[model samples]
Target: MSYLIKPAGYQALLDLQQTEMGIKRIKDFFQQNLSSELKLRRVTAPLFVLKGMGINDDLNGVERAVNFPIKDMQDASAEIVHSLAKWKRLTLADYYINEGYGIYTDMNAIRADEELGNLHSLYVDQWDWERVMTPKDRNVEFLKKVVNRIYSAMVRTEYLVYEAFPVITPVLPEEITFLHAEELLQRYPGLTAKEREDSAAKEFGAVFIIGIGCKLSSGEPHDGRAPDYDDWITETENGYRGLNGDLIVWNPVLQRSVELSSMGIRVDREALLEQLRISGQESRQELYFHKRLLAGELPQSIGGGIGQSRLCMFYLRKGHIGEIQAAIWPQEMRLEAEKNGMPLI
Candidate 1:
């Protein structure tokens, strides 16, 4: 079921040794740029949390978390985090972080249910970050401002990477274009959601599509978003809606749209209850995290994860994500990549 492709004339921009060094350079440079740009401090994060704590991210509200029972704590279960989407917000409150400041962590996760593909594997790594914000900051304008800052950091990282390894030419645009999901749907009414993204990314070079979770005019969402996080359904000013979106860039080597990050303004109490109701997840209201959030115990915040391997693949000009990160791939995929001179890590 993997969507395999052998990009014509594709080749790794860096060899095995150079790739290893490049990864460190990229990770270090990007993290520094990101932290400085967003005023974020590095923090340590947990690999797993106690089951039933409502701290684990229920991505798409269906994918299961890798869970097991703690031997000494009878009947106590632990689940590997899918993402720090919820945990980061809780941490901001726990650390007593004030508004205008935040924290970022090197988040590692395992998504056992992830479909194997050129862009996906069971292993996941990202830079997860969250910041405290006032109620007045949770709007479309602020969301756009944050998105631009992240994009700037990405651009700066690209420049540094190319400077260190001149062999890899920069492919990112000077500025990323912004588009609404509804606008994209209207432009390509005949195309499916993925196809629409591909079309937009190709046209714009880089694009951020807003209003991801809510039902569009076509009676379906541009993409599925968990209700407990990203405020994708809230109505904001200036005819803008949904304070969350994904940052996508057209990968020239793969000839496809690659999503590097999914971020947005976190939901407030009202938006949380409303989004949960819309997604028919009202039962989550009884969960500990949800209950605490509804009771105004957590901080108002904005956060998201920037995929480590995805960025590496894109910047390294590799056709498949496996070229950047070590992961299991189907035998056929391995043969295909080998045939094209693209080796799996």
Candidate 2:
């Protein structure tokens, strides 16, 4: 079953026109800032890739992609991409993008299996970006540096929002705190994974949790990750077991932590084989995309998706993601939001 949160005493901060203008302002400023900060070029991306090619991301290794048969093409099936995680890496090789430069796209997707909630939606929109890197750059320190650059872009965008919408004050910290998932589990041994995130974000205002997807001392993984893309199995220099993580911030309005992004270094030959073996999906290595990676045909890169509506919700101080994006909501959900004075767009 799906879940929803209705913040008490919630009220729309901006009218329809004002909200539209605010979204535009935020998108414009942040897109420019992010591209410049990461040295990325805007590119067109595919909404769907041919099925059975292993070109699409299998998010969490469970959610099913929306698929259909195309008649004109011999009834070949096409799967709507869950995210551009794998596709972006292939694009890097196809375009021969030099090291240190990358591509970013406005990735739109439909998560048919998604659970409706305060932030969850069937429709997903994000800035899916990837940058080429050398094997030497696949370390915790380099990942932290890239994360800081992204955080700086967000900070500048927050200041811009404050200048325009004085009512929405800037709340993001000057710097985001970085902590490993194991460290977090140790600090809050009694709390669940989500609870730990809330506690850390509340304390630091913003935080980046490193070493996700791998099992900690508790014997269960902090979170599940697909075995193909993110090198979550690799041991880091800091003695952690993951090379990727998520950046989250405490949303004062929602009184909960909202994850802004998840990224990591792409799995190299060694990492991929091991992760596949551990996940018990070694047969995937024979797939086309996997074969290319195994043959060293793709570039070693770092990539992730940053939600567009989530960012807008943070800057606009909206209580629910539906307020920032137009998507079909359950009748009861809509009525409850409306009754609580939380306008859904």
lDDT, model 2, position 38:
89
Give a tens-digit lDDT track for model 1, residues 1-345: 676788998777788998888889899999999999899999999999998878899889899999999999996899999999999998998899999999999999999999887799889999999988899997877888999999999998898889988988888899999888999999988999999999999998999999989888888899999999999878877564698999999999888899999999999999999998988889999998899899999999999999999998888888888888898888988988899978887
Taking all chains together, each candidate's TM-score versus the true structure is 0.97, 0.99
Whole-structure CA lDDT of model 2: 0.92
Model 1 shows how many backbone clashes? 0
On a 0 to 100 scale, what is the lDDT of residue 241 in model 2?
A: 90
Candidate 2, superposed: residue stretches over 4 Å from native = none
Instruction: Tell how far residue 300 is off in model 2, in angstroms.
Output: 0.7
Pairs that clash in candidate 1: none
